[model samples]
Target: MTNRSRPRILLIGTGDTKADELLFMQRCIGEAGGVIVMMDISVLGDPPYKAAHDKHAVAAAADKTIEAVIASGDENSSMTLMALGASRLTRRLCDDGEIDGMITIGGTMGTDLALDVALGLPLGFPKLIVSTIAFSHLIPPERIAADLMMILWAGGLYGLNGTCKAVLSQACGAIVGASRSAIRPRPQRPIVALTSLGKSCLSYMVELKPQLEARGYEVVVFHTTGMGGRAMESIAAQGGFAAVLDLSLQEVANQLMGSVVNSGADRLMNAGRHGIPQIVAPGAIDMVDFPAWLPVPAELADRPFHAHNRLLASATSGPEDRRRIARAIAAKLAEATAPIAFVLPTGGIQQWDQEGEPLHDPEGLRAFVAEMRAAIRAPVELHVINDHINERGFVEKVLAIFDRWVADAVVPAGKVAVERI
Candidate 1:
């Protein structure tokens, strides 16, 4: 049996003295069997003190050195630092454990540079920073990604002082331990992609989870935000999902008139190319979400706005918007080779679209149903039922459709025969 290879770490340091520090750090790193593949030093602004102290001799030494040197200066220079560091980090992560963890020791500017590198990595990757401003909340959260640990440093220089040694030791251990720990790689399960906005399809998820699990399918829910829809489509492109249950498609309305959750022009077309089984419903086709106080664009300012919460409001779509949305949805569905089913609820598409609700728009609903029926060319099975979006009857209908699909997918073996002997 072949032994597994140890992880390689890229140790990045700033200024000239880091070369000396690297020797010491390497000793500790070697104890854990870490292979330091690359050592890079930053030369920003002033030259190293050793060269300055040596005067004329320093200039000749700098020219003779063959080590890779990255220069840093103004804003653009700082950006270059981030870009180079991020490139190295990305290569290491991809080659190693896909970035199990990353640690950086720096000051304010260093923190800024390191944080930018962290942000370029994926969301769940571990990030650690040793900085003077560790306690400041002003640091942007986006810079840290998800798993971040920050340490405060009293002095800038690396010394043999008790505190400095202890801190360095801990940081090394933390990075190694985190990298060694079990990482939950993205699952390979047959993903069932479902779309929902917080408002309409919360109950749908609650009801759908058990039904999906009972049939041995993994449910992946995507909120109908701009990024959420894009992420689901990206995952589908990466062959993540076995099927898609697009329950709430408010993003279609948004895409039509340039609203917030507008998933680009491709939208559902990507899933079609992959030939994944898809079932779609116009769950929240009646509205477009936006911030409460932002002036609605001149074209849509007149549309009815309902305050869903203190900060969020949605503009109720008119008949025309719904028709446009339905057409777009149908166009995407037309491209699918896999089985496609669409369900329509006669009572309401969402709680706000029901009778007596502030956003009730019957004309919009009617136009949506009419346009979908007219545009779909792929023999879409449409079931119009008189039930609310979240009613028990509606959930049963959705589950039954999925169950039928699962049953049809099975190939049964059978034959009893008495052969002559």
Candidate 2:
């Protein structure tokens, strides 16, 4: 096989039982003009061929010796050690620009090892797994990364055959294809991260994205879906964003109130802790989300409700819940050392929050505002705008804050231009 200047894909799996199949996949990748970096993670046996990262090095990376890893002699302990070791080593390889993508094929233990290492990589760094558990319903969100991909192992089990080879070849082609195409040459613009509930709530994001792009800022929008918020925060904590437009905070409410679509605990704190300037709003704070398949919790069914679709539903929060949400928002903002603007859209926060809508609870809104006023102090400037969040009036107010921050050099001015879309 000849090497091309294409992506070097990392193949990680057990060498004890699956070495033949792993080596077969390696040949397929090589024949496809891709480079392969093979890792042997088996505790009990050796690979058929030389491995780039072997069991000994894998164990050592985890602060354990291969002998100790083997001494444990259980599948759980062995897989755990190998996964920990592989994660550390793989991340370092990525940092040093050694591997462009990673893939693994295995059954149970192998799947766990592959996932742990691959998930440790950053977003857009193509990672794939051909596993028997790919179709399992018990996947925990924490085990999966934002962009990881998986396919059923199908006919591939103990050895390589026509059926398994076809599957393995497809996986090879996928990683190679991803390596060639997934990562873009990042634009030389400042990055701004924003959160919103799509069109389900009329959001400024539709207008703001292009405006920010026109100003030479690359805008990244994260839906306030539970995982969406967590993904945004994960990247933000890694210093990925120059500034944050955290306009939709319903995830905070969802989290506090036990909704299924809430970002995890560390949602709103990252950009602040990273010293990035932010414009914060309690957008869509009037509701909590639940999957459409599930009945509204008996406790929550009494609130005003909107069936957004068969997939999403929103339930209005009462005065007490609104007050609790406001306090939660305030507590999170209080942790920020960076400059922040807390803007409240006084007229309404969401589409269903306007006049004649199901969730238009002015009394609850007032209670929320009162709690916010009682909780937030200076250094976090507060502003109240009289228009609904979806209105141009609210958009302009947010842009005005952006412009002011640019003028004060709190954020990069970029090539300033804002055009209506």
Candidate 3:
């Protein structure tokens, strides 16, 4: 696109500190079929290699002079200023169609700056960071762009060694390869956004995806992990999807119960805000997530627990929590400017909520039902089906409501379908 044989890869780093490492990365990228562009984020010292844009240019980009930033001499504030500057500069390069991909290497301060810069770019753009804390839980999901890749800066810090060079060479090759093989956006289609937990909880997504595709609509299922729900809401808010099947309401219960897997404050409200035709359900509202690494919260640790795996454990929602979550969901639905079909599965919400399961909680389900029926208002069609969420009957009920929307012209009839990703 830039009329170049090799894609241009932007090398970003704090030149004052890791100049040698940054310079090494630059050379490695060049050897790996990538044209190198550099943006030096140094605050106190010179870069080992001359950057296309240096520390002075960076400070000026943030509307602050290099002299002023240096005068402050505060590591924290200076790093923040440099990151803002880098983000601004990176955005400009993207707008100008100059950068094809980007790679940044850093420890604490460097990693922090990389996050700001990488998040500034749009999705599908190749952004990679080689960081010391690549696998750490300290990273915030909200800040990191969905497609950003990170390599553990394994031995590639301080100075060059055989080990560090090996790691750097691998990172360089990865960024170049990624740039050469850039991802193209999915073709235009009527995107049906669906949310769910894994196959352990719901199988309706698997059943409905093909059925919807057969009817000529692309089904995009968003896993209802905390970040997954937020990402779905992000895309939906931007009008990326034509319709939304918000089948998993676990994030609502997670939010109400103060679980680690809560989406955010504005989870269920985005589709309503953007007037997207959405089918809502009380899927997986029976449980709340607790991190397996830590002990469950003292208040409800005694509740019915199901260890989903090593990393995640779930506890059954109580009647009070379910009622609160139902009210929250209802309130969000009430504000919908578009048609909403809210489906309730009477038999069970998830696999674990079935007969004789560890997560069985009829009292909590009853509370949710009582509150939902009372609180939800018009423009939202409520359907009560006497079957489990994974059952064929429940799947048909959802499809029927969506089909009705199509017939009523709420969802356009001549929609195109996309192959499942």
lDDT (CA) for every model shown? Answer: 0.62, 0.84, 0.84
Best by TM-score: 2
Summarize candidate 2's per-residue lDDT along 120-220 as a digit string, tens digits.
88877888999988956345444666677898888876687788877888999888888867754365778899998887685688889888887788898
Worst 10 residues of 2 by lDDT: 135-144
lDDT comparing candidate 1 with the true structure: 0.62
Q: How many residue pairs of model 3 clash at the backbone?
A: 0
> Model 3 off-target regions past 4 Å?
2-5, 56-82, 155-164, 262-266, 269-275, 291-298, 330-341, 377-384, 407-421
Per residue, candidate 1 scores C-alpha lDDT tens digits across 1-421 of 1112344444444434444444444455556655543323344333233221121222222342222223334645544544454545454554455334455666666667666555455434545676768856546322343345677755546544566556666666665555555354464445588887874434687778767765666677888765577667656654556778888877777777776546656667666678777778888878887767776666667776688776677878888878888888887787776778888877678877767777777877888778877877756777777787878877888878877886787211112234589
Q: In order, how many clashes per candidate? A: 0, 0, 0
lDDT for position 285 in model 3: 87
For residue 102, give model 1's deviation from the true position in Å. 7.9
Per-model TM against the reference: 0.60, 0.85, 0.84
**TM-score of candidate 1 to 2 decimals:** 0.60
| Model 1: CA > 4 A from native | 1-182, 186-189, 199-202, 410-421
